[model samples]
Target: MQYLPIFTKLDNKPVLVVGGGDVALRKCRAFLKARASVTLVAPEFCSELLEHASNNEVILTQAYFDESHLDGKMLVIAATDNESVNNTVFELANKRNVFVNVVDDQPKCTFIFPSIVDRDPITIAISSAGTAPVLARRLREKLETLIPQHIGPLATLVGSFRDNVKARFKHFADRRQFWEGVFDSSVVSKVQVGDTQGATAQLHGMLDAKAEPEGEVYVVGAGPGDPELLTLKALQLMQQADVVVYDYLVSDEIMDLVRRDADLICVGKRLGNHSVKQEDTNQLLVNLARQGKKVCRIKGGDPFIYGRGGEEVQVLAQHDVRYQIVPGITAAAGCSAYAGIPLTHRDHAQAIQFVTGHCKKDGQELDWPSLAKPNQTLAIYMGVLKSPHIQAQLIKYGRDASTPVAIIENGTRKEQRVVRTHLGDLAQQIEQHHIVSPALLIIGEVAALHEQLAWFGSSAQISSFAQPLTDVA
Candidate 1:
């Protein structure tokens, strides 16, 4: 970020303004609003400046700009028309380590004022680092309309009871939960209706009741490598979750959206490498929920697809734990759309089969007869390791060796790669290109349509084998 946004307390602090014109007057008023002791230095004073001085709102000095005026001042503003004067104030302030703002000069200013939406104690400041001040102002205007007036009073009322709530709930998580529960209850409504006494009573009663916090699990699909693909419900659950249980497949971008305070547990599972066992993950969820924690089991792609969300939900059900399932865009759908590859085409494919390369008790073969059928697309997840077996089985089952295939690695992401080749060279291309996990394999004539509908990233075909084609990402 160009500038880190922060609120400074300037109440009763000394501030110097180096102009007596309207611009200086405007800047001086800002300091007065912050309850700062403002003094303006200029040879000539504007009518508004004279009025302010008469009312004792600000101290006026009838003199030219001088470095002596900057002494004992917490902040300095050069609002004069002279360029040299503004530059001098900027350099001098930097040497003295005092925050300075030269009006209308972005580069000269050490600090810039932001467009603010004030609601007494609740103030929202928006800035674009002086690069787009008008845009920032527009954003502030939009926020002004969206934010309700009742929010300030509600916050003020709740703030009064903060000491009581803090003493009641010893833990940080418990206090947060209490606040969340209070907001979800009718306390907010009472405040909205201007019933301060009733709201206070309700809040005190709820706090004294000491109700046990309910625990629930949210089975959310994070989608394939793209944060934007997340469902609204999934995002909501993730933000409110007390704990987030994720794996390797969930993208970093998606993980960033989780609540900042949420505890993260990685149970990442890759081929031949398991950070945490599946059974252990199930037990962990159950244990956490039993302790009154809201757990978010976030998975990549649709949870019910190849994501193993069903197994986790079944365990939660057996433990009598409450849960909500939110589905996400699966790999085949998201990756294909981003790669410009249609999973099913009118003339090329009539069906799609979602398959997995690995199964329980390894080497247990899939029904190759039905899989090898013509005019059907096979979206094989986790099939990079068993590409040779897949290629051999399909060819051996009377399926043509020249069948088109597309391997999408890190699909729907900026670093996504699409390696297109025939089914005969599926395994060869994977080895040659050093293709990694989190890749989806699309096999069938529909895969060939990638050439015509292709758009997205920069990955090209390794070798078409039957027919040479250009890049597809």
Candidate 2:
């Protein structure tokens, strides 16, 4: 390594900066953030530096740079534009064995600033040994998005319990196992959501054996076709799952994010083909949790919407199993945004309703009068099979036959298709486009906005309707 990485304890340590311009101010700010006592020697200083000195943030020595200014300083920085003065400071500091950095002069720097990703108590510093500063900054930017903000608080909470945990588990191996269990338990989830008190209480209970090891279910919504739309909490739980229970609605890209070693169980339902019965799936969740396994029941869009997450959760509750609900971006919100068709527009729709064309065996019939009311947008899920029936009933109940409509297939995915047509031609467009399952229907004036506001999906707006045919013996 060109440079050895080490974190310094610079709290209250005196640091010196030689110069008074913008460059000098930049160095001082970094020192201030580290809680270092800074002293600057300059003939003239900028207004911002003057204001900082007025607030007693830094001590300003109004004099030209000299060897005497380097006395008793832990670190020195030369930020002057004058080459001769910077060289002098570097030489003098080196003679006194003090760490010195000459701004913009790599060879003269004994210590260099590193790109930092600061999550408070957790700090990640990336340095290219002063060779690739831009690349290091880009790496820091990427880490900023991947690392959650609650990490610092979580670390602090764990630190506070270190003594207690050590006292409880005398053996090193036992203590390690205890902590591994904590990370794999609901404690981490509680901490991630900023419930520190609850986490601490749970931790104490575990160390005392008051709470035994048990199973949990994270009923998470995977969002509509796009993996990027998954919530942070959902991502965290997905990686921690021992078994992932998924459905056909969840995109293929999302299934790839689950724990590689986890067992995948598909209870996905499709048009006229159910992989597993709903009652059996609900019982499966209860049985898995009873066996002490962390179950991730991932569904497309919001689980509470059309995903039947409530029924599964109710079963878990009846069995006295613990679970967490992580809401995801529903199809209506995601598909409309990606297709650039607003579900509710002041100029077009005053109200929005979520409907499902497929219903339970004993489900009540839909109120066509209310559904066909004017100035409202309808987002229908799983409406492909009933497209013809929906069109006839809406027109029969007073909805205009000329009202615009759109059918979005594989909404929000790369191969997404949006078929725009009028209410009178809704069934015709579905057949003409050869639309498949997993499609959403948008009905109202706002559906016409696909031509104007559709920005995310490709301009083709319509996919090819042709499919290859196969010959059978």
Candidate 3:
């Protein structure tokens, strides 16, 4: 933000223009349009300046630039051809803390005029900080054509009933929802067709109608680690939500994009730490929506894939709560791509299994016989703590000990680290590197391609790993 944009009300305010030629006349016209009391101070006046003075549009003084001319003025503009006079006016204005502009001279000006699109009450100002005025003007021209003429009238019409609407709905959220409904309704169509009377009638009718408020839940996937991976619909729901219920897996960058005022509730759980229980989280979502509050239930990766999203949705459905499920890229796919390891490859493996090594309960085991089959890939999520058991079981089930394996820690993030080894050393590499949670284990021949095809996070990778084959062939 090189320059902060602001709209000033110069209605009847005193303004000084330190020039009487064509440039000064142009500056005076802009002030007059804003209903400012413009005074031009120049010894030699242009013909148009004389005409304006004769019509009392601008008061003209036959005098050179002086410090006294700035007294009692809200704004000043120095448009003279003399650089000395422009610099003098700039210094005097700054000394008095008054805003000033020098025509065609950005550095000397305290305030520069922006290219404007004026639709009366709706004015759009575009500025390039005086770096590229032509580009700014082109942007303004495009906006002027894209913005419909009916918007100003529509705003005025809605503004007229603002007080009445405020009195009708005491809560801000209720008022916002009501306005959103109005924009989606036929009232806007009537205004577009120039039927102001009909539009006003429809607005009044809507205000008179009484309806019970209902809430909706957005089960959004924040995606695997990267904020950019989140879907557009997920982002929209996050902004619109009155409350955000998130997990620890969601990145802080993604959390920053949520509505600033939205109430945040962290149900985030780690391997051994649980902030809020799952049952309590489900009940909380039900209770919030029952109060007519829009709730955003955000999780990492696809909600159905190891995210416990289906459980939350089931609770909402049991309570008759409305919800929309937004899917996200699961860790298996996101981590593999970021680590340069394909989950399944035609030459390496034809089958892929997404397995969870750390179960919710102990004494539970996966189908090791089928998992240890050849020409297959296994993406084991949350496998750090149970890596030794997993490795031992796979080898016991006839999976070769030399089968390639890769451990991706903090996948798809700036701090991502990929440790490549063999299936026999899966647990050894994890222990040696001190790999932590949120890491994915890619096992099978497809994992060997990580060293050859790996691209991202290479520079960020730790240097203590075993010798990495530099050449693929």
User: Which whole-number lDDT from 0 to 100 does residue 16 have in model 2?
Assistant: 98
Q: Worst lDDT window (10 residues) for model 2?
A: 464-473
Q: Please give, for residues 1-473, the per-residue lDDT of candidate 1 as tens digits.
A: 76788898998899999998989989999999998999999999999999999999899999988788899998999999999988988899889999899999898777889999987678999999999999999999978865656779988999999999999999999999989888755566456557889778878888998545546688999999778888766876787788999999999999999999999999999878888989999999999888878889999999999888999999999999877888999999998887678888888889999999888876687999999999999999999999999999999997898999999888887677778899988998999888887899999998877887765423453231222233432
lDDT of 3: 0.86
**Clashes in model 3: which pairs?**
none
Every model's TM-score: 0.59, 0.89, 0.59
Q: Model 3 residue 26 lDDT? A: 86
lDDT for 307 in candidate 2 is 88
List CA RMSD, all candidates: 10.7, 4.4, 10.9
- Ordered from best to worst TM-score, the candidate numbers read 2, 3, 1
Per-residue accuracy of model 2 over 59-159 as CA lDDT, tens digit each: 99999888999889999999999999999999999999999999989889999998998887888999998888899999999888778888888788888
Of the candidates numbered 1 and 2, which has the greater TM-score value?
Answer: 2
Tens digits of lDDT, candidate 3, 1-473: 86789889999899999998888888899999999999999888999999998998889889988899999998999999999999999999999988999888888777889999887778889999899999999999878756767778888899988998999999999999989977645465457668899789878877886433456688999888877788876886787688999999998989999999999999989987878888999999999889867889999988889988999999999999878888999999998987788888899899999999878677677999999999999999989999999999999999999999988887777667778888988888888888887899989999888877787525644342233422211
- Segments in model 3 whose C-alpha atoms lie over 4 Å from true places: 1-206, 457-473
Top-lDDT structure, candidate number: 2
- lDDT-better candidate, 2 vs 3: 2
